[model samples]
Target: MDHKQIPTEIDREVRIPFQGFYNTAHDNVFDMALEQINTDDSNDTVEVISMDNVEWTAVRLGYAQKYLAEIDKTLALNARFSRIIGQKDYAIGNDILLARVDCSKLVELHDAINADPARKAAWAYYVKEALTERPGFIPYFSAEVEDWGAFGTWDDAQIDCMLAFRGIELEIDETEIAMELMEYVDEKIWSSVIDPDQVPGHVNNKTETQLST
Candidate 1:
């Protein structure tokens, strides 16, 4: 009796569900850390857990606005299993992770900074440049304004508050100040999950093509 092994070909078209947040590196780190923490927890029946007092620094307003927009878009586009537990509450459970930022805290920080007159002027200049010169910048700013509608308008007072918190003074040029602020925001809003050792088979095929060409 002869036995023949069946040939099999794995379909590479199937994509695995990717999880985690886009903004803030700490978010991913916290996710990994939480897994470890939950495994170590003695109580099995605990339904809710609060991880508070995670110190966060103020990022640039533009960056935060962009990051939030990206997150909202991603959530809307992707059909994922994750649930948004609360509209304004922050909580993380076994099957769910709720992330939220304290707008009031940010507002307070902004208020303290805007108390300085010189900083307020510098912030105004920066905002003007952002509005007129950078077309791409407007959407994110508009979204932020809409989000913060409940807290009043995104006027000079609000802009001054944000600038003041960054310890920015009126002596600095608007362009330079905007650049600095954007850099801070970029850091806060950029995050990724990369498996350095893993390379897709399609990548190898592309490299082979390049070599032949």
Candidate 2:
């Protein structure tokens, strides 16, 4: 994939459905770590156009903001203090894996759907099964919003399962670029699943160079 595809801004006009948040590395050190993290050294074919900016049905938005500057600020802080942590099980709450993404665009989209009589009526009729079957449909993000409380109608552990299931989407203008950015982040974190050493750790408060090597 062309790393250059990732852009630095968001088109606020577009609204997207998002899943959760992910903490990703953005600097040269992180990039080098990612390269080393690839145990197979495989040249995988990364799809260019992603509707949700992720390859997974359940994408991890991972604390991503509408603006790249905000993301960079957080990454900088994390790197400065070497604050990255790890978990044995992808636990929810407090654990980075369980984090939720808050985007006004998604809130606005849901609101628009609620306000339109036809649109509001359509979700129940056509989207019931689809919504329930959404790769990880526990409604984690939806539950946080007051207006999205309608999803609470199906109250159950299914929501919890969805949270565990790591599938989510984020919609925005320049969606393809956004998707590329997400893919870039996932490459580093997901590698940890294969090789636990890739998970960022606070080893003696080590710097990025030490972590990458």
Best by TM-score: 2
Query: TM-scores for all candidates?
Result: 0.24, 0.26
lDDT value, residue 66 of candidate 1: 40
* Candidate 2 weakest ten by summed lDDT: 204-213
Candidate 2 has an lDDT of: 0.32
**Model 2 misplaced regions, further than 4 Å:** 1-110, 130-179, 182-213
Residue runs of model 1 more than 4 Å from their true location after superposition? 1-99, 133-151, 155-213
What are the lDDT figures for the candidates, one per model? 0.32, 0.32
At residue 204, give the lDDT of candidate 2: 22
In Å, residue 160's CA in model 2 sits off its true spot by 11
Residue 195 local lDDT, model 2: 28
Tell me how far candidate 2 lies from the true structure as C-alpha RMSD in angstroms.
Answer: 15.4
lDDT of 2 at 40: 41
lDDT by residue (tens digit), candidate 1, 1-213: 111211122111111111223333424444434344334357453312223311122222223334334443422222222222211223332112222323343444445535667755565565555444354343345422223343333443444334332423323233332333444333332211122123221111111011000
